[model samples]
Target: MPRRGKVVLVQVAIVLSLLLVWESGVRAGLIDPFFFPAPSTLVARIGEWMSTADFWTDVGVTLLETILSFVAGIAIGTTLGIWLGLNPFAAEVVQPFIKMFNAIPRILLGPIFVIWFGLGLTSKVALGVTLVLFVAFFNTFQGVREVNPVVLANARLLRASKWSLLRHVYLPSATTWILSSLRVSVGMAVMGAVVAEYLGSSAGLGHLIAQAEGVLDAAGVFAGIIVLSAFVVALDAVVDRAEKRLLVWRPAPAHEV
Candidate 1:
């Protein structure tokens, strides 16, 4: 079997094993169903939720918020990162302020965002943007800063225009770093949206989970969590595919024959 297939098989096996163990424990009265629903029950609950239109609407809202956050964060972060990276003086001046903002726990900003933007998609997207922005900025800044001095000098010797240099030299150099940051930012974006929804929203998976928790419906909560997990996994997979396509120039690691 191919390595990827084998890896996937193992992952599936591991999950099944865990589910089997959990189900067995529940049946044996070794685990409390109220707190920890059986895997089967969780699956059934998820199916039931999926059959409803409300669930899909919640998913769509969450997905929209996440996508908006990811794109806005990347656009703003990349621009600022490139600017500050090229202008060392400006970077130095703003470094303290950036650090201070980054130090602020983003979760605390959720309620503030809700109040500022209202308890809707805007607030969720704002919170997610905050969560994702720093990650992209740091990675992109380092990427641009780490560009090869020799390559830059050669480009300068060729009388490359600023735009030409940015397009050909800087962006290409930073692509890898930016993409790496994107993978990490995916989870951050999702967390931001969900947390914001949980804090003050009428819809989204987070609201669903929050509702379930309020009613002490363990199965519903677990089912919501499972759905969210799958959602993240799907987004991560899309990122993975995009990364592969964009980084086709990247060399593959060597393998022993």
Candidate 2:
């Protein structure tokens, strides 16, 4: 088998082994099935969800929120980060306000968002954007600031226009930092969406998990968690592929760690 196939098989084996051990422990009364549902029970619950149209609707709602928030956060964050990077004086003036906002607990903003945007998709997306924005912004800011001073001086000597300098010098240098934040921001976006739904929402996987928790259904909660994990993995995989494609010009390391 190819390396990728071997890696997949190893992953499957590890999961299956753990499941077997967990199932045995539960059956032998060493573990409580009620508190910690068996893998089989969770799988069965997930299968039931897969068979229902409502489950798909919930998944779609969460997926849309995640995507929308991620895109919005990246767009806004990158623009501001680039601007701040270019103008040190403006960045210094805005520093305290940025710090104050970042220090605020994002979870606390969910209720406020619900009040402002209503208990609709808008609130959920807003919550997610808040979570993703800081990560992208900080990374991009650092990337731009870390650009080589000598190279920038050379560019100035060459009489490069602002647009040319930004396009060729700033953006290329910051691409690494921006892409580094993409994977992390995507996960934050999902968490923000789920948190918003859990607090107050009529739909989405978070709502489904909240419902299960309300009824104390361990299997249902576990199923919801598994579904969410799968969703994140799928999204992260797409980001990974995009990062590779975009950074193809970057040279590979001499050795893998």
lDDT of each: 0.94, 0.94
TM-score of each: 0.96, 0.94
Give candidates' CA RMSD values in order: 1.6, 1.8
lDDT value, residue 119 of candidate 2? 83
For candidate 1, write residues 1-257 as lDDT tens digits: 99888989999999899999999999999999999999989989988888999999999999999999999999889999999999999999999999999999999999999889998899999999999999989988999999999999999999999999999999989889999877799999999999999998999999999999999999998899889999999999999999989999988869832
Q: For this target, which candidate reaches the highest TM-score against the unseen true structure?
A: 1
TM-score of 1: 0.96
lDDT score at residue 191, model 2, on the 0-100 scale: 97
